[model samples]
Target: MSGHACGSLRHACAALAVLASIGAGTAAAQQISPAETLLFETEHLARVRVPATLVYAFRKESNVEPGFKDEVRLELAKVNGKLNATLHFLTGVHKQDIPALEEAHGNPVLLGFLEHDIAEMKRLTGGSTAYFRKRIRMALAEGAQVSLQPITYQGKTVQAQAVRIQPYLNDPMHARFEKYLRKTYTFILSEQVPGSLYQLHSSLGKPETVRTGTQPADAPVIDETLTLISVTPKQP
Candidate 1:
C-alpha cells in the first residue's frame, strides 16, 4: 500500500466508475439502492487497481536524421488517493534523485486504512445504503473527478462539477494533468451473476502521438499506434 493523496486525478479517476455504472441501475436498485453504497464498492475496487509503481519510456527521433532516444521511468504510490510517492528517472542515470522518490511515497495511516476499507467493500458489496454511502463519501472526500457538470444515472440525470488542477498537467508533455485533460468515457456495469455486476466501457482518453526529431523544427513522423487496453473484473 503506497502512500499518495486523492486529488483531482484520483477524483477524476474515481469518477471512472460512473462510466461503469451505465447498465448498473437495475442491479443497484434491487440491491444497493443508495447511490453512496454503489459508489463505495466502485471506489474500493478502484483503489486496489491503483498502480503501486508506473514505468513509461519516451524517445526523441528526427524525421530526416533519426538516432537519439530518451526514456523516463516513474514510480508512483498513493497518499489519500492523490499521487504521493513518485520517483522520476531519466534512464541513463543509475542513482538519480532517489531521495526525492522516497519522499514522494505515501502516508502510513492512509495505507493502513485501505486494508480495512477494502474489507468493508467486500462486506458491503451486497449490503445496505448507509454503509455504501459512508465509504463513497470517504473516497470522494479525497477529491475525485466531479466533472461532466452532471450526467445521467439510473434513469435520473445528475450533474457533476469539475474540479480544477494545474493547467499544465493537462498537457500530455507535462507531468501533472489538469482537470480539463481528462478523457471522455461511457461505462455500463451489469450483473453477470445474480448479485454481481461486471462493468465495461469505452474510455475516451488522449490518443497517443509519436513524433520523431527536434521540436520547433517540424519533427518528422515516425510511427503512431493507438491501442485500447480493456479492463476485466479481476484485472481491476
Candidate 2:
C-alpha cells in the first residue's frame, strides 16, 4: 500500500469482492441468473490474452459543481497461467492486485468504478459501502432486467448486454437521502470487448422532458459515466 492508499481508498476497497475458489462462486448455493452470470460469474478478462493495457474514459457532470474528467489505466499480465491485473486505481500511487480469473473476474472497469462511486457516496452521505454493495448484489441476482442491446465500440456496433438496477430507490434510508432516491446504475457488457465491460452509466434524478434534449429544472445532482476507450495488447 502507498501513502495515498492509507486514507479513504483503503476503506472503500472493501466493496471489491475477493471470493474463494470453492466454485469461484458466491457463498450461497442457488441458481444464478443471467444478470449475475454476466456481472460476476463470467470470465470477462479471458477474452483477451496477456499482456495488455485497457484504458477507460471517466467523466462526471453535476449541476451543482464543476465537471471532472480523467482516465483509468489497467495493465494485464499472466501469472501462473491466470489473468493478473494491476490497476492505477483513480489517481495517485494507489495500485492493487486484481486476480481477474481467480476471484471477482469481472472487469476492473465495473468493480473499480462502482467502488469509487460507493466511496464517494460514503463521503457525501456517511453511508456504509457494504449496505450499498449488498443492495446492488441483490438487485443483480433478483431485481435486474437484462437484455441485449447494440452499442458502438471502436467505431463499430456490437451486441451487448445491459444490466440495469436501482439499488437505492427503495432503500431503507429513503427519508435520509431523499435527493438521491432516484439514483440508477446501468452496466453494458459484451464478449467482443477485450475486458467484456463496455460502459457504466449512473445518474440521480435525471428526468425526461420534451424531445429537444433538455433536462428538467430539477436535473440530477450528479451524472457520471465510465466507458472503455480501447485495449492494446503487448508482448507477453
Candidate 3:
C-alpha cells in the first residue's frame, strides 16, 4: 500500500475509535428490537450480488480544484451462505484484497470502508440504525439538530436521515489535541429494498490539512459520497 492509503486507513481507524468511545457510555441505554434482529439476520444471510462504484474526491482548498479523483469497484456477494466483499481500486495504488467473510451481527448492510473483521466492518459501515441512534442521542445531548427528509440519488429517491454534530470535544484531557470539529452525516436507504444501503453522504467542517499535516495551508472542507450502482438479487 502507498503512504496515502496507509494514512487514510489509519485516520479511519482513529475516527472509529473516537466514535466507539462516544457510544461506550450509552451502550447500556440501547435496545435491540426483534424486528431489527430479523432484518439483520435476513440481510446478512441473503443470496445477492451488489456491484458498486465508490468515487472519492479530494479537495485541498476551496479555490483550488480537486487534488485527485479515485475510483474503486466494490463487489459484495454471498457464497455458500457466507457474506463477503471484494474491493478493487482501479487507480492501482493499492493491491486488491478479498476480506474474510464473518458473521454480520453488528452491521448487516455493508456501507463503510472495507475491512477484514466484523468489528472493523461495523466501524467502516456507518449506516446502521443502531449506530445512528447513538449519534443522535449524543447530538441531541449536545444541542444539535437532527432531521429526516426525502433525497434522490442516481435517479432513485429515498428517505434520508441526518444529524448535525456541533464542534464539541469529549475528552477533557485531550482537548488540546482535539480540533474544533463539526460533522454532518446523511444516510439514504430504501424501504422497498431491505438489508441494503442505497447511499451515504458525509460532510466535515474542518479541512483535510488539519487532520493530515500535508500542504494546502488553509483548511479545506471534505465531502464523501458512497452510492450503490446496482444490485442483482439471487433467487432461492
Candidate 4:
C-alpha cells in the first residue's frame, strides 16, 4: 500500500544521480546513461513493503550443457526502518553463499543476477572473470540502448523502460569465445511492478536460435531469464 504505481519512467528521470555508493563515478567525471542510472543507482526495491517475498522464476536452457528450472528468492524486511534484503541466488544443492545486501540499496536482484551470470560466462567460455565483469559494467555505464515500453502489472498497463546491450561484440578479446559475440541482454523495469524489475533476459547463439525461451532447452542455443513471477506478504 505504500508504493506508487504506473509511472516509473518519470520517477527514474527525477531520481537521477551518480549513486556512487554502488560504484557510479561522479557525475562530473563521465557521462552515465539512463540504463546505468536505473540499473545501478535507482532504489528499485524501496517501494515494496517490508516482509514481502519477491519470487523470480529463473529458467536457463542450453544445447551445449545441462539446463535448469529454478528460482531466485528475495526476502525483504525492515532493519531499523530501512529496507534490507537477503538474496537466495541459488537454492538446493548448488546454493551459493547467502548475500545479505546493503541497507536500502534497492537493487539486489540486479546485483545478484549479474554476479551469477559473470561466473557462468567464465565457466563456459574459459574467459577471465575480470574481462566479463568489466565489459558488462562498461556497457551499462555508457553503451546500452534504452527505450520506452509498456508493461502489464496487476492487469493494468504501465510505463516501463527496456535497456538492451551486447557487451562483448566489440571487445578486443572477443574472439576467445567466437560464438558468444552475439550475446545480448534485455532488462525491463517498471515502477508499477512490486520490485521494479519486470524481467532480465539473456540470449546467446544465432539470431534464429536466440529467441528460444523458458520451455525450449533442446535448441542449439542458450536462453535464460529471471522473470518477476510473484510477490506476496512474507510469513512472519
Best by TM-score: 4
Better structure of 1 and 4 per TM-score = 4
Q: How accurate is candidate 2 locally (lDDT)?
A: 0.67
Q: Where in model 2 is the C-alpha error above 4 Å?
A: 1-30, 92-104, 206-220, 234-236
* Candidate 1 local lDDT, 92-198, one digit each (tens): 53223332322222222122122222333334244443333333333333333433334343344444323221222223432221221232212122221111112
lDDT of each: 0.29, 0.67, 0.38, 0.71
lDDT of 2 by residue, 72-116 (tens): 887888777666676765564323333343322546666677777
Q: For every model in order, what is the number of clashing pairs? A: 33, 0, 2, 0
Q: For model 1, how big is the CA root-mean-square deviation?
A: 17.6
Q: 3 or 4: which has the higher lDDT?
A: 4
TM-score of each: 0.23, 0.78, 0.49, 0.80
lDDT of 1: 0.29
- Residue 182 lDDT in model 1? 32
Q: What is the descending lDDT order?
A: 4, 2, 3, 1
User: What's every prediction's RMSD, in angstroms?
Assistant: 17.6, 7.4, 10.7, 7.3
Better of 2 and 3 by TM-score: 2
